[model samples]
Target chain A: MLGRLNHIAIAVPDLAAASATYRNTLGTRPTAPQVLPEHGVTVVFIDVGNTKIELLEPLGADSPIAAFLAKNPSGGMHHVCYEVANIIAARDHLKSEGARILGDGEPKIGAHGKPVLFLHPKDFNGTLIELEQE
Target chain B: MLGRLNHIAIAVPDLAAASATYRNTLGTRPTAPQVLPEHGVTVVFIDVGNTKIELLEPLGADSPIAAFLAKNPSGGMHHVCYEVANIIAARDHLKSEGARILGDGEPKIGAHGKPVLFLHPKDFNGTLIELEQE
Candidate 1:
């Protein structure tokens, strides 16, 4: 089962601008920004109580975030991640329910260094969801 | 400016079945379902951690949710609400930054007996957002 909200991902054209916007709006700056080469994006986390606001910016035009930004240039809420106890079990259960898994087999290490797997947007309406287990 | 997560909105066709799906998945049932006349929909809330997952079902074809479910019938994640301290001020500031306001002037009372306002999906890309302050 899912626990607390791990993070809410936001896709932005510019991470610095988005981080500054949240800082000015929320009264705090984001944590250090980190780049994920595999994901082809850079992310910055702004702490919000127990939850976090993750700002993602594509590193290049070939990035998936770039494609998303093209459709929604104004930036928007991308995905919602829920904390799970056993990701493999959760993934299996979701797959059985006809949810499509984005990745291959096992979960991969995410930007947070936790084991994470993504559910295809096709299965989850138009939203891309992530499940993480620390 | 933000308090805690108020509710996570999820779009679904069959409210009863979606509620059942979550109940079977989360090991608990949703709170009593309620219909909002103004919103033209019925909603059910499933408690999770300090937040709640809100399952939304359109009451008729004219409902905005109906359009959303039409595009993605498999059900998907919707908008995320952040509890705010002052709805009026928050709305004003977001508007100044070129964010489009959806509803008319003044915040209205929502189903939970709290004051709420909505931001147009244009500002946040494809996401329709609601801001609640109680």
Candidate 2:
């Protein structure tokens, strides 16, 4: 059900520094940073021709990324997103096979203004997985 | 310049079990496992339409993934590979901008029979990055 690799999300302790690295340093001309209060993250997207690199920073202490940064300090890879033809179908299929959908098992509007759902890290080899509607 | 995302690699404690999870559980048939002695890793690629999910397991105690697993225990996202039109140019540009390429600053033949170079995790917001020749 996965279509294409949509984006690889990284949680960064310092969003500005990480954004500058991809923009001024790497010359990717990243998109302007955005704050998603619903998700508790400030995000920026660096285009890589066919895909994107998402840099995320916690918006508040209760943010999940904040918890991740508390443990990792320097931050790290947070999740990988893949585009799916139909996210609801994909979620249903994964759920039927015993995969754990994160949160309330419902899709949320993501940074790209698309329906997205996160899968539990445990079911995905300790790597958080995200499914974005294509 | 970075092209498309080639793959997202996840380090796993057990290659067989991880491979089975992707195959039987997720229903994404993966490629046959390949052992890269030089890198001290055994890997499998699960096709996801436009990109692949690379599952990596340490072949030896000295493998980089082994060290990551030592810290994470359950294993996790290892690195991400992006395709570049000309890897040498990409490497040279990144170097001029002061990005620290890992190892001896030289490209090595990766599992896909292409020139690949790894960048330091420190230079990329604590996430290891790989550049592969497209």
Candidate 3:
């Protein structure tokens, strides 16, 4: 099951520009950019204390964000991450209920260095959902 | 600045089926459906303790979700609602930052019975953002 809303991730064509919007306009300073080579994304977290806004940019040509940007020249909300107490248990439960998990059905080390699994967008009403073990 | 993420909304084709997924599959109970004729949406909230998952279904043929579903048959994540301390201040700040607020450039009473405004998808990288005054 899902816990609290961890963060909502936006796929941006330009991370710096997006970060500047938060910093200069929204008055929220974003965290330093962290590149996740495995995911092919460079992410920056805008902390709002209770939750965070994650800005994601394509790290490489093969990155998923790059493909997403190709379809949507601008950027868009990519996924919403929810915290779960136990990811394996959550994954198993979702699988049992016929919800599809992405990426070989295995949990991968995520941006927070915690185990994370992505649920298929189709199963979640076209919203790519990510479950991070807290 | 944004406070806690109040809820993330998902547009679904079938409110009952989607509610069943959360209630039976995900093990989360959803609240009763609330119809907002003004917004043309029928919504149900799934409490996650810290936040909620708002499931939206089209109230009529002209509902925005109807158009969204026409493009995306299975439904998808529509928009995310963030909580702000002051709606007017937040709207002004976002406007000054070059964000386009949807509607008549004013806050409208939202589903929560609070002043709410929607930021254009273009300004927020194609993500429809809703700011609700807490």
* Chain A accuracy as TM-score for every candidate: 0.89, 0.92, 0.94
Each candidate's fnat, listed in order, reads 0.32, 0.61, 0.72
Worst 10 residues of 3 chain A by lDDT: A20-29
All candidates: TM-score: 0.85, 0.92, 0.94
| Candidate 2 backbone collisions, by pair | none
- lDDT, candidate 1, B1-134, per-residue tens: 66666777888878887777666643446877898878778999877686777888888658867777877787777687777888988888876767777767578887688898877766554556678995
Error of 1 at B99 (Å): 3.6
Poorest 10 consecutive residues of model 3 chain B by lDDT?
B60-69
DockQ of candidate 2 compared with the true complex = 0.63
Alpha-carbon deviation at B111 in model 1, angstroms: 2.1
Lowest lDDT 10-mer window, candidate 1 chain A?
A20-29
* TM-scores of chain B, in order: 0.88, 0.93, 0.95
> Best candidate, DockQ-wise?
3
lDDT of 2 by residue, B1-134 (tens): 66788988999998888888787656688888998988889999888877788999999768878888888777899888888888889889999889999989889998889999999888888888899998
lDDT of 3 by residue, B24-102 (tens): 7677889899998988999999988777889999997689678878888898878888889999999898888787888
What is candidate 2's TM-score for chain A? 0.92
Interface RMSD score of candidate 3? 1.5
Worst 10 residues of 2 chain B by lDDT: B20-29
